[model samples]
Every structure is written in C-alpha cells, then in structure tokens.
Target: MRPARTTVATAVAAVAALTAVTGCADKTDAASGGKGGPAVHVTAKDDSCAVSTASFAAGHVQLAVENQGSRVTEVELLFPDGRIATERENLGPGTRATVTAEVKAGTYNIACIPGMKGQGIRKKVTVTGGTAERRDPAKDAAVDAYRAYAQAQADATLPKVKTFTDAVRAGDIPAARKAFAPSRVGWERTEPVAESFGDIDPKTDTRADGLEDGQKWTGWHALEKQLWQDKKLSADSKALADQLDKDLADWQQRVGRAEITPTSMANGAKELLDEVATNKITGEEDRYSHTDLSDFQANVDGAQKAYELLKPVARKNDPALSAELDKQFAAIDTLLAKYHDSHSSDGFVAYTKVAPAQRKQLSDGVNALAEPLSKLAAAVVK
Candidate 1:
C-alpha cells in the first residue's frame, strides 16, 4: 500500500524556503557519523520529525530511523517532486529500521508520517559537497536490466488484469474469482515501482482501511470483496473494473520512466519482504479470498529477482552478507513451499486455513530474511 504523500506544491515551497536557510547548507557535524559517510539519524515522533543534521556529503547516505511515536510511522527520503528516493514503512511504535538511499548534491526532505497517513511532517535537508559519481559500468548494467524486468512485469500484468476485469464486466463470479489472485502476481512482484508513480497505486491497490478520508475504494481487494464476500456484482462493479484497467494501463506505460538505481533496486527488494511480513503474512491483504500465500510467494520472487541482479556487486562487497542472504532466502522459500496447493489456481492453500503457530513461523522467516535484506542497499552502493 502507498503511504500518504506530501503535495508537490507544498514540497516545492518548503524546499525553496529551506534553501534560503544557510544552516541547512552547512557541512554535517562529525558527531553525525557512519561507516563510509555521515548517516542521518531521524527520530520520528507523534508530532515531529527530528534529524541529527540538516546536511550531509553526497553519496550513499544511511537513514537510521527510530519511531518514538504512539502510532506506527514511516520515514522517507523524498526528491523535491515527492518521488521516493528510499523509505521504510510499517515501523511500529518504538521500532527501528534503517534505509540507505543514494543522493547527489541537492535538496531533499525527511518526512515522518505518523499513523502512516495524511500529509506527513516534513523537514528539508541539503545533500552537500560531491561531484558527479563515475558509476561502475556493471552497476549501470544492473539498473538497465532491472528496468527491463519491471517493464516486463507490467506488460504481463495488463492482460491478466484485463481477464479479471472482463470477467467482472460480464458478471461471471467464478471466472473473476479464479482470475483475481492470478492477476495480482506481476503487480506484487514489482510493487515498489508501481507505487513510485504515486497516484496509480492508491487507485489500483488501496484497501478499504488504507483509504484517505475522501478517496474512493477501488482496485483488486475491493473487487475481491464483491466477488467473494458479497457474492454478487454491484452496480458499480463494471465501472470499477474499467477504472482498474485504465489505472494499470497508466502504470504499464509509465514504469519504464521510473527512477531506478542499484540502491533503489536493493531497497525495493527489502520493501517487498516488508510487504509480505506486514500485510500478506497477517492475511489482511487477501482476507476475503484467502489468497495471501500467492501474494506471499510473489513478493519473495520479486525480492529474489532483485537480489540476483545485485548479487555480483553485493558478493564482491560483502561475501558473508551474500551467503547469509542466500541461506535465509532459501529458508523462506522452503517454509512457503509447505503451503503449496496443486488444486488451487494460485498454487497455495487458503491463508485462512493457516494456523496461528504456522503464521508465526512465516512471520519469523520473513524477519530473518529482512535483517540481511536491509543491508543489501548499503552493500550494493559500496
């Protein structure tokens, strides 16, 4: 799910005002330290976003985020136009997570969203003092390849979504039911990219609970409820189906233009694992249809695909991390395979049937993988 965003005009105006503050443009203090560069420390509380320093030297910067808030919070490093450079979400109260993002010498924001909704509390930051990086040719190749992969995933999703939507338009409950989980596989695989487009994800994937005050509930989950829980099509079903197709088509066309870098790929992989743990494993994502396992597997597949692409760099930089990641990923895969269902169209038993103990195991496996996966961004950019 997409978190609430800062508006472009608001962000731009804030950035402009912050640009005039000489203190924000000053060099980072030595007390703000990290291994290879200054790591910006962010303390996200219920009402404020606090940063250790307003500026840092350009390169790979680590954000060590701690949520001191009562509500679950998220911290993001956003570009001036509100595109995510890198972000860590679903951070429960008092929990800590690290996000590493590649930043050039420029202005950016450190946004803390308490409750993971509404216009977030924003702080302007200056990424100061660095010349253009002479990036490794191999890393450039990885970015290109990942871009192709994202585009391919979008291409594959369109027709599958069409099948589902077509079934919806025709009032074929059984066909829509069968097509629902299958249609979402490709989207789940590259969700971070789709999410980067901002408006598209909310329209196509937001859950009933994730909606804003005035936002309409559409997308796969909304349709899923109609087909499974309500057991009949509503008058709005066809219009909603058409809207899904159009929103997705917009994603397919715009995905090629998404801002993808090696660090973003590595970070996106970690985000996928988080998606599984926070949403899919809890069975909240597919509560109506009980197809959470299908999403579970797809998220793992996406994360693995990213790891595979970045493996050469990560292996070279930190071979031990590479080894640990490989072992943990296999563990997750093995655990998930226990739920495979040959009879199901999506190849997994209904998530509703998973026992509490079994769900805890899945959650544990995801956390194990997440720790190492979180290190991937820092490793790749090194």
Candidate 2:
C-alpha cells in the first residue's frame, strides 16, 4: 500500500526541516525587527515561510500571516518546548489572517505543507519587554501608494502580454518584440524591488537557466535570446507565452475573489523581499545546472505572485498611485527592449566578460533600483 500522505512521521520530518532554517536571517529578522517585539508579521510561500523581524520577549503579540501563493495552506508557530503557540489553517491565496498569542522569547518554527519539507525554513524571534512600536502612519500611507502602483502596472501589462504572445504565435518577430516591450516595462518598474536582493548576472550565473545552458525556453532572457541569438521562432516560445497568459488570468480571478487588505499587501511585500534576498544570498547557480536557470527565476516568480495578490487592493484603494506605477512599468519595458536589441548573443558574451569592477557598477545600478521601488511599495502601505 502507498504510504500515508500526511502521517505523523512525515509531519515531524517536515517540521524539523523548517526548524533548521528557521533561525536564518530570512523570516526571523522580519518578525523580530532584530529586536524584542509585540507586533510580528509572517509571510508564507510554497516551500518556505518568513517573518518581518526577529528577537522578541514573551508577551501578548499579534502575529499576521500573509499567504502569497495560489493554493490554500497553513502556518503553525511552534515553541521550543514542543507547544503550538498559534496555527492558522486553510488560508486562501492572496489573503491574510492574524492571531494574537502569548509567546515567550525563544526559538520557534514556521512551516508550510508538502513542498518545503526538511529544508529548515523556521525562524527564531526573541521577545523581551515593552510594547511593539505602533505602526507608522506615514509608512502605512506609502505602502498603500506603492500597492496601488503595482496593481495598475500589472493590469496595464495584461493586454500587452496578450498581443505579444499572439504575435509570437503568428511568427511576427517585430510585433512580438513590440508586445514584449510593455511586459518588460512591467518588470522594469518593479526592478528596484528586484534589485534590493543584490546583483544577478544572467550570463555567468548558472542559476539563470535557459540563458546559462541554452536549454530552458522561458522568461526575459529566453524571449530576448530568441529575438536576437537564434533569430528564429519556435512553437515552444509561443507555448510558454500562452502559459504566462494563463497564469495571469488565474491571478486576476483570484484577485477578484478576495478582499484586498492593507495587512495582506504589506505582509505579501515583506515576504517577497525576503524571498528575493534569500535567493540572491544563498542560491547556488551550479545546483540548478541540471535543470536550466538559477533559483532567480523562483525569486522573480514570488514577486510576481505577490503583486498579483496585492493588485486588486491597490486599484480599489488608490487609483492615482496605480497610474504612476503603470507609467514606471512602461518605462522598464522600454529599457529592456533597448538592452535586448543592443546586446543580442554577441552582446551578452561581451557584456559578461567585462572586468569584475565594471560588472559591479552594472550590478549596483540594477540593485539600486530596489531602494526606490521599496520606497514606492512602502508608500502604498502607508
């Protein structure tokens, strides 16, 4: 007979994996603020979970869990003494739930079901004394602003994606390229948020997949390579674009079904930022060699997922900020087009060979975008 899917043994092992990585910088710092606390925020994803800050004292605390993925999942906060302080069950995608628990300052484990077993994604938050800092009204406003922008950006890009995918399917390179520009813009406006994690060299990093080994056929590099390097269209490219379109549609549907709350969007953004940092800091390019690209793809995937969840709330909450985000998203599209047209395969080869010092400058430029983007996001929640 097949093994039981949710057996105690399986759950124990999964919980253990979460415990190992729980103390890593990702979730803990987010919840504890790297200090003692009362207000804690936790973000949950497919294979892992993260807290907004770290190190808290034992007391009454409000713990918020933001579900950024599509599927329903649970997040459980386990104490060192083998007690469950809090457990949130069946949290729908793009939604959030909160629990106020009396937690002692110590180590704790946070885990997701199925995928991240034995990976040690748990976090340790120390609770000491004093009430948690009151939420900043200004920062809260900024968060709301950026959330609006991000949602508008997503909405604007949908039509462009449809056109681009259709053009690719029709074997119209120029048209497809034109369509691709807008999608790239969506990414660019958000690039600052993407950059905060650090530098990512698509060429040298084996983790970048399709760009590194020449097998995978999706994402920015994949589409860019087809337009320039291969100079030939294939059925797979169209198929991949179609998949993206479907994903976007699903995201739209989910957004419509849920209520967009400030807590949910803020929690989602915090989680995405941590995921990006985790991928940039700890991901090994060579580990993904057998597959295609680095976990950078996963990193971006999470950001996109979080945006989808926050988009509706943003649009409903702040229309003007949403418009501004759309404009920036469009600007990003133009930049990618210029970069792709100039670089090609030959350009990528040469660009990748630049001195490390020069590369650092480029990396700095890319990563620096995160600050402004983060500011924008923070503006939304404010």
Using TM-score as the measure, which candidate wins? 1
Q: What CA root-mean-square deviation does each model show from the true structure?
A: 8.1, 14.0
lDDT of each: 0.82, 0.44
Question: Best by lDDT, which number?
Answer: 1
**Each candidate's TM vs. the true structure?**
0.90, 0.40
**Candidate 1 residues 150-223, lDDT tens each?**
99999999999999999999999999999999999999999999877667888898878788899899999899
lDDT of 2 at 266: 40
Task: Give the lDDT of residue 59 in candidate 1.
Answer: 73
Off by over 4 Å in 1: 2-35
lDDT of 2 by residue, 1-382 (tens): 0001134444343233222222222132234221234357777777667787676555445566776865445565665653445544434455454544444456766555323222235776665665554554544554566556555655765786688778878889877655554454443333323222112212112123223234343454455557655777766887766766775544433333332234434444434333333232221111221111122233344344455455554555576655554554444334323423243311222233345464334333323322223322323433
